[model samples]
Target: MSLMTTLMLAGGLLLLNGAAAPAETRVDLALVLAVDASFSMEPDEQDLQRHGFAEAFQSPEVHRAIRQGMLGRIAVIYVEWAGAFDQEIIVPWTVIEQPADGPAFAERLLRNPVHRMGYTSISGVIDFGIQQLRHSGLQADRQVIDISGDGANNTGRTVTLARDEALAHDVTINGLPIMLKRPSSLWDIEDLDLYFRDCVIGGPGAFLVPVREKAQFVEAIKAKIIREITDRSNPRSLIQPAHDALPTNCLAGELRRHQPTAR
Candidate 1:
């Protein structure tokens, strides 16, 4: 080959190789805010849920937590899900390093329109979260799936299966069980927090914060995000240890949704 042609071919190969190897962003944590938008979550409750997450990102404590991380940065994605096949990415992976980035992230979350879909599928969201974490073009020291929902896994495969799979992949699962209203629906189960602790959350530092009232949304979300970001596993957050007997039926939602009179 001519010298000029050889140099051009070499440059072409270099460009092709570089194109095939995409750069990945490194951060302290990769957090998937997997929210629920099931039909059971009333419109007002959905509003509170969105506001809570938005305000949590805008909080001083959360900002401080992110800043204090070893890398001083974290990657986050917001997702909403319902049913086994219903999942939407409200916000793609974004890095938050400075104080301003927090609000910017919050703004992105708040700007999106809220959604309410049929059925609740905790397992679906968990599996979706795992996919996002693995494919997210970001390298992180930790990965977490934050689940906030009012109902249980009615339309998906077993919740524990998904939880265990994520744990096996070194991903922690956290919970914010919204219990503002009484468990009046067939899909709603009493002791939702216990359900989350025993069946949903697991990993090295897994914990859950139950939201029992409307007033606690913002603060509860803020505290949970801080704990996840700081990697502080407070046993107090869990109602009981993981090895203990399941406090509530892990399949209660599935059962209730299928057989309304089983309870």
Candidate 2:
């Protein structure tokens, strides 16, 4: 059976297994926080990223944004990913409607140990995000995959194909390109933000915030979350239309990994 068919069957099974059909909760947004835990991310960077997210939820601004939403709530799941098949859901679907919900979610997120795995797979995470959104069992006004990574897609299916698939489903993808360290190795791309702009993020009002300094992590995460919750365009972010020309190579990560280097 096709993946879509399987998903439909699984959803049906949930209702059939229950005493009564569970009413799907309605929220302003259903968000997947798809984070990178690839080996390329140093231990310090990993900790910083984790704390950044945890703190973002605790911030008053994010809470205020949640309050101002049409339904005054959002459902979110936290996922850490690396390689084609390496994806772990650190925090399961949690609805954040009240002031206490955000902090509770953050605490649960921090309780999990941080881990790093092999390869960088933006495509893998996107595909995973799409599946999770479909199976989340929450009705949302908007669905988004908020991806933050230090590198590009080095494994799995083509990133653009996965991105296009998500766009077809009306799932918006936003990006956070971590550029703290200068690009010296082949694994690193100097124009990662551009790669995200031309390759990764898509759908309505998709944008990216490039993190070049260590100090910006907390603020960046908070700002991005607020913008997403409000579903508004931010002037400070690098907003790109879906049809923009590809200036940076979409296949740069794959090429760097597979093809032989020049003499």
Candidate 3:
């Protein structure tokens, strides 16, 4: 009854129910775009983030990256997550084979209204991403969860545990750590890049693009998407390395949130 065993049983069931199995779409990648809609992000910041992604998808570069893929297409889903139970799928799995598909995907994405909710559950988002991949009805060369967040996990299970589990299932977890401003809460960990590198991202070719300024958001997302679509091997040069000077406490958020206050 373990997670792995459960997943295996689910896969077996899918195979057994041949008539119920949806036709698997063969693509270069099966990607889950997990965006953060946590309370820490302001309305303006949320707008920026959403527009950045929408613009990236509609760009010529992303289109070219899709065409460069072996199958000339990729399946992607967009999920917005905030609290443990606040995960919502804004876009279901869609195949993008040609340049025209990019705008259509972007249109669908922009049509949805952004929702802001409490808590930052990195673990919840990763777990949700795993579930989406399992039901994606697409046989892809690479399975990736592209998670973008401005804060660390302060709710639900440990982020590292979810990350490790995803890696174990051959799923890569990449990150987009937004460090535009310091969170007002004491729970905010200053070294979010290190936290992401050590606890949030994993598996083959996993890398994070940290957005340090508002102006860089669009470009950062664009670059991240292109690299993901192309399946680049060494992304170290493209992303800033984890700050070795600042030791990352993976449990920093949890500890700060639950710490005993002045009596």
* TM-score of every candidate: 0.87, 0.88, 0.88
Worst 10 residues of 2 by lDDT: 12-21
For model 1 the TM-score comes to: 0.87
Error of 3 at 68 (Å): 0.6
Q: Which lDDT tens digits does candidate 3 get at residues 1-263?
A: 67954564333222112122345868899888999998788899899999998999899999999998878888778888998888877766777876777788789789999988888899999998898888766798999999999888888999999999999999999999999987656767787887898889999989888898999999999989999999876724545564477657888878877877601
Q: Which structure among the candidates has the greatest lDDT?
A: 2
Model 3 CA lDDT for position 109: 84
Query: Residue-wise lDDT of candidate 1 within 1-263, one digit each (tens)?
Result: 77853553332211111122233777899899999898888888888889988998898889899989999988888889998988887766677877887898788788999987898889999998988887676688999999999887887799999999999999999899888988886777888888887789899888888888899888888888999999976756455435645456888888887784743
lDDT of 2 by residue, 44-153 (tens): 99999999999999888999999998889888888899999888878777788778888988998899999789998999999999888887677889999999998989
lDDT of residue 44 for candidate 1: 87
TM-score of structure candidate 3: 0.88
Better of 1 and 2 by TM-score: 2
Cα RMSD, each candidate: 8.2, 5.7, 6.2
The number of residue pairs in model 1 that clash at the backbone is 0
Note the Cα lDDT for every prediction shown.
Answer: 0.82, 0.85, 0.83
